[model samples]
Target: MPDPTDVEKARSQRRAWEQNELRDFLERQPESQQEYRSASGLPVQRVYTPEDIADTPFEDIGLPGQYPFLRGPYPTMYRARPWTMRQIAGFGTGPDTNGRFRYLIAQGQTGLSVDFDMPTLMGYDSDDPRSFGEVGREGVAIDTLDDMADLFDGIDLERISVSMTINPSAWILLAMYVALAKSRSLDLAKLSGTTQADILKEYIAQKEWIYPIRPSMRIVRDMIVYGAEHLPRYNPVNISGYHMSEAGATAIQELAFTIANGIAYVEQVAATGLAVDCFAPRLSFYFVAQADFFEEVAKFRAARRIWAKIMKQRFGARKPESMRLRFHCQTAAMTLTKAQPLNNIVRTAFEALSAVLGGAQSLHTNGLDEAYAIPSEMAMKVALRTQQIIAEETRITEVVDPLGGSYYVEAMTNEIEEAVNRILKEVEELGGAVAAIEAGYFQRGLADSAYTSARAQASGKRTVIGVNKYVEAPQKDAIEIHRNDPDVEARQIQRVKAVRASRDNSRVATLLDALAEQARNPSANLMPITIELVEARASMGEIVKRLREVFGSYAESPTF
Candidate 1:
């Protein structure tokens, strides 16, 4: 039973309306063989009317904080509590990252999202030979508790939520976060943050992982079980689709694969001795808001509906909170360009608006200067201010899901939901996300989409403002790039060496031994040992190295 008000209103509007200006202009215009179209190859009509979304429901497409959550996760959303002003940053060493964190905080960033270098992701200490030339290169290198302490030196861990974009070695890092907060005497139960412990997606898309799929799932299950009982306020896994999009997925592919991955993780944890209603509520997700504004908005809406359905129908999620798909979205970093980079401000503004409209829990906009290097100080401020202005100046936030009843948006939402369900069916036919990953289902899909898009750009079928449509001479004067503090690695090494010197070497070894024992014995829950190691302030590398010994690293098959 669909609500009839919107449909009836649309009928009346279409019956009475006239595009007189369009009719006049077309009558005087010369006929041409060429035709313009949307990048997705959809026709560009002169206008859309209520006739477009005439069948949409006023109730099913209800207000924010309600079922379907087409509007948003909360009724007041940003009006009640503004979206987290989190900026992605981490580079050089611990102290270097700490300084950058402080700088972003000063620039009005509401939260911290840490990006780690290769060594940290691979679970290697900075001085390890395998980590040569990699530590502290692209993102911060954290190997020890001293590094973790330095990473949040002056910042109060309880006040601001932290998002650590790390997996495979997530447990070790999460342990360090808990330890640091404990050092500040912050309540363990009240610690706020999320760790990117989504290792299944590592196998699916990102490929930054240290363990085989099954062992990794076991580790993730343990973290969920542990976080439920221990760090209740902290989210254990941020099931991410941002990397999938960066890996060249179309918007729908990102949506389906990410949701399917979430399904897989929830299934695994549910099989664990814990109740489904227990930890599912703490789960969080990360997604990328792509350039197709309406399409992206629809994707978010569909995701919420699909997730709610998945939780209720599939996982038997009883709590409304458990059924809700709370997520953090960042603008597509892949869309930002080094050419006419200033135009990225315009690019980011629209994407940010789309995120707000789609009802994101929080968002991170890429810096205008990101494509070239870690954004300069000024560039970061502009990015943060971009979100602030949209929040403060734009009254869009005052209304929850203002576009909810729009014909095109609701239609697109249904379209994407159906497309994602079809893709999920195909994925299931290949034996679910992990098996699909093993078969390269996701990888090949993305490669095909990327190839198609690239060809379109090359043939000028798609218009990317400056790149394809409006050609302009390149802007002069390179963006100011931030350099690695040359002495950072040395300082980090000294800090680790000193911590290792002061820590009880025997106790550290004993805790490391216990962690190794737990990893070796699959039936043993590692949380008990991890909490002990965390309480002792064991370094991230020390714990990760022990797990690496047991579970071993993964090697992915390359694309043909």
Candidate 2:
């Protein structure tokens, strides 16, 4: 920490410089803008000094791996090992996406992230009427255990980490993954992966939920308990803020809302007679690294500090792992532009850099062509190489929290932490995340922020190069956009139908009945029965339908 007397002296000198020298300079050559502000609308001073963080306690900004974890969650950060480069890939049938997965691995991707189509994400079979024409449009379609097998055909589950970006039907996918591992004679405890079972965020921002909040929370609790007891290496729920950010939340809102959702999950799980330390250590987070480089970096730092304090002070967590807020970062897809599509590569690279500087555990760089469609093979390789260049070429990984003591970064970190704490308090007063979601608090906040951002862009307050500034004339298409397989829906439906025909209807019906009976029991853990249902060759839609009969469904109230 800097000496208080020196800080005071510096502050006095700074005021003098600003009053005389800066005033004269500005008069001679006016600044670009009247005032400068961050992407979150917070003021950004012309220059930062030690005086800016004079009031901040030294302990609050401790070394990496220490309590509060402002610098980072790990002691060595990227020194021991670089973050896992997990580029997301999914489109068309399970086999099709599996090809992409294999390609990414061959190109040096360390982990796999699955992106599911709308039908699969919504717990619908490819043959279902609601799933027609949408089976494999946006992402891969997985309806049965057979599809899960095809998706990970030759991949070694025990050796590689996989992440599934599914919400409403996340449990069904997780069950299929477990069933697949078992069929391969793999140890469940040795499998490491993540299921984005954050139903609360689905209700708050993503809007892709099935069961009501309480029932959905119950399902998430069941997964947490099961993972703690069985799949110890797996992260049961990746409480995510990425959707919220893409839906138009400020950086602070994303951090605060995500941590609040994490808190809600902890409370729900703790209510199930489980110790916080037992499962909290496996809880992970997902966030978006947006365009605001410094703000994004500060947001990640503040997230670790805030979560550590919340786990230790509020939840009585004793284990250091429980307090560590490990997260996976994805470069913001919303920032990608269709105008100058290739420019998205630069945007993604900078965002990926911010994630690395902020000490992300894992990262996914967006493909350059993602603004128009799913990434082509070439674009995916470029995105993967961006991380490779950062990890190998750039020497940034040699040090931990390279910007730890910067006056600007520390001040920004403190500001973001304070702002997030205020929002967390508001969430608590609203009776927690579920209650707030029901009251449309989060929805309203997101909508307002989105509107504000849109207005800013329209009025030229925000400088989105291709969209609002440095405009360029439209030209002929220069890059090929990825197109989904036109016959994917038919193929997926046929595969799902074949699986149903091969399985015994009587056994599937019996298993689903047992699952419904267990689901009706408030104290019953649904994971075991769900796993059994998947193993019996029952489709995901069948299992979800059975649970829906027992738990009903959710409908969000409209908010202006």
Candidate 3:
């Protein structure tokens, strides 16, 4: 044989090459699965040369923010602006939330994402019997306008963007927000931020809500209309795929379901006869960054390209901004392990890296102590520091879409898009996402993937550093777990009672009666009455009860 060239010589030197060569030779004996691939399942070749990416032209893979937007959103992505740091906050009372907001701001956090307790999420006042055991259990308690006002007391609404996580009661929260900003003398137009007004996902994943589906959609439509007309800077809905992923959905399930839900929202609002381009620009998303680093990054790139194509091609959107999907990301919570909490730090780091690399607009790294409970200050600091190190110490932000044209990444992007489309087609066959969700398609998918993932973990096919490998003895020192003080409940209940006692009870009754009347009509948009009722200090339970009078409560069958 002729003398091997330098390229061939180098390729032959690697141990993996010999293994691959041996496998290639054994293919003659009997081939089982010719296509071995990544979790996203892009084909893994024995080696990649220029041949693998020959068809992926430079034009198709143009610089960031180009027509395709496959690489990144902007050419000078992080060089122009770093992704916003938004730690998911809100615990105890409004004053407590205020202090935490100030604390994060003082510590160099760039944005704020608020979390709410189970009662608040389900539209229950702290005084309600339903809210008794759960007041401020998971997050902050806001029973009326006073609590909402106190929540952002000194924080300048115009200066910093905020994201509130709430569903069925999203419009009430928005109304409270508007009132708070008005009290602070902030112009409605100058206000910025979002509300997790995504009700569809609640039925799909989170399972926290008050009203029925059609009525819930109306609430969302009202907010879309309000945000477009008055608060142009505000995102009325943060349509989330993050929680779906946290609920153990696979990456493609997260992508397809989120985009499908987005499609439903756009359609729902348009049914109200609003222009597509008006509110679509401000529509945002939240996705999880999981352990599959490269796949997660490519999924984001593919998401932008897909959404841009859908809005322009399918929805006939002319606005460039309508095509762009601005989103926030949090590292995968499902990946955390109580067995080896310290390993969580490294896990969060990798997932955060994936988020930044994936071009997330905002992010939150789950604290290591999250496996046990609410994070301690030390744990939260470590989580924040993870992002700072990646942003400042490492020079990853120097260029936009740094891995834009890697052959492996490009291949992975195509694979993920294809897989997500296949799933979307399956969803459509079931008569759209809502119908599919009702039929338990999403839950089934999650269950199957979760089972597979769990099996992998049990079999040691998946390597969790401290849990399955590099094992360590349990430490004698006790790690601190943050607990919500029970006084938050008493104070919240007392505050609601005080408002009920002092407010013009007749006007409150009148507004609530009107709400109940409109709610019974089913055709009435709840926003105007919701705003009026919130202004009148009607408790969340009162508003929920009004709706519940007409549309009966649902008992969702176990999806899996």
Candidate 4:
């Protein structure tokens, strides 16, 4: 490390240069924005210098894959292999989605992400009156193991990684996945994928919750423990900040609250007698890459650093793999504007670049038409092409941590790391994530930040090209919207009813009764029973109904 006195001398000289040379130049040409701040509201300086991070030691910001992985998790990173091109795909029936999945895979997509419709996300059968017209409207509807089997038909589970984006009812989907793999005679140990089973985030932001908070957490804990024991190659829970960011959280709140949630999960599993290292290595994260390019990059760096320290120091994690934080990223859907939809292509490119520069392990770029509806086939292809252009054409993958030593990037990384730490401290004082969540601390913080952002946009403080500053004529007719088949609901209802009728009612009842009996025990692991229920052709609604009886439904408080 360099001497502190030498660093101070260099900083003093730089300050003199700024005062004498830069000040006179700035008087003639002012900046465009009156106040500079990140999407997270951290102050941005006109210029950064070594002095800004003089106290940050070189050892603290070490080489890639090292402890406190601020630089990058893997030393070679994209140089060895570009980030996994995972496209989020779903809309219509399982077979419909399976076709789209095959299309993307043939188009060079390396991984798959499934998005479930509202009813499936909420654990409702397509035949439920509550489902009505919502069946397969927003995403694919998976009511049973047959749907899951169709979703991955002709595709090898042992070869491809699939990420299912369903919460509140995530365990049901995982069970269906395991049962489908068994049907194919594939080893469960060979299957690799992630289930977005982070139920805590539902209460904090998305609100797609079913059971009460504590009981829901119990289900998530069961999944983690079961996955560690059986599905060694799979990530049972993808603790996500993507939804929180989409719901309008500042980047800092997203990182802080997410890490706090991870802390809570580690504690929950450890309390079950599983060591932190046993499960922490499989614990992956999902985050959003927003419009503020450099800030988003810095946020990713700070996130890895913070998680490394937390796992190593706070939890006393022994393994290096356990401490290293790995995450997947998606471009911000909230930032896309329907007005000049072509502009979203450029916006997504920049956001994707931020994730790459920040060392994302996998990424999904939002389609140009995503802000309006499910992407058309053309739009989805264009989105995948965008990532291909970045990975192949840009030549950014030639180096690791390409912007590691830049003054502005380094200073911003330090600033974000400090700010996120302070917020984590606050969360800790509130008795960890669950307590903070129950008290409405995380929710209120996000709400306030969202309000501030809305005000900024409304008052012209923030310039969103198509929404606020750059006016444009409406092109509702010109944009091609991907419409779900009108008969989808009727068809899904019929299929579900057929499956229910074919199964023996007596055996279904016995399995459900056993599930309820197990739910009554606080120490039971729910995955084994869930897998059995799914394998028995038990409908999603039947299983969810049984668990709901044991773990009552949740209703959020109006105030929070």
In terms of TM-score, the best-performing candidate is 2
lDDT of 4 by residue, 1-560 (tens): 34678678877887898898888887988777788888787889887766777778887789999998888888889888998899999978899899999999999999999999999999999998899889999999999999999899999889989999999999999999999999989999999989999999999999999899998999999999999999999999999999999877988889988999999999999999999989999999999999999999989998999999999999999998898899999999988988888999999999999999999999999989988889988888888899999999999989888888777888888888888889889988989999999999988988888788889989988888888877888876657878879998888888898889898888889999999999999999988999999999998888998899999999888432
Candidate 4's TM-score reads: 0.98
Ranking by TM-score: 2, 4, 1, 3
Worst 10-residue lDDT window, candidate 3: 1-10
Off by over 4 Å in 3: 1-37, 40-43, 57-59, 476-478, 520-524
Which candidate has the highest lDDT of all? 2
Alpha carbon lDDT of each predicted model? 0.81, 0.92, 0.82, 0.90
Candidate 3 lDDT over residue span 49-141, tens digit each: 443455565665666776567767666788987898888887887888888888888889988878888899988888888888788878889
Residue lDDT tens for model 2, 1-560:
67899898988999999999999999999999889889997789999998989988889899999898888888998999999999988989889999999999999999999999998899988899999888888889999989999999999999999999999899899989999999999999999989999999888888898899999999999999999999999999999999999988999999999999999999999999899999999999999999999999999999999999999999999999999999999999999998898899999999999999999999999989888888999999999999999999999999999988899999999999999999999999999998988888998999999899989989998889888998899777868989768899888889999998899899999989999888888899998888888888999898888888989998878554
Off by over 4 Å in 2: none
Give TM per candidate. 0.92, 0.98, 0.92, 0.98
Report lDDT (Cα) of residue 16, candidate 1: 55
Query: Model 1: per-residue lDDT, tens digit, 214-278?
Result: 88889888888889998878999998988988877787888999998898888888876677889
Error of 2 at 101 (Å): 0.9
Q: Which candidate model has the greater lDDT, 2 or 4?
A: 2
Provide the global lDDT of candidate 3 against the true structure: 0.82
Q: Which of the two, 1 or 4, has more TM-score?
A: 4
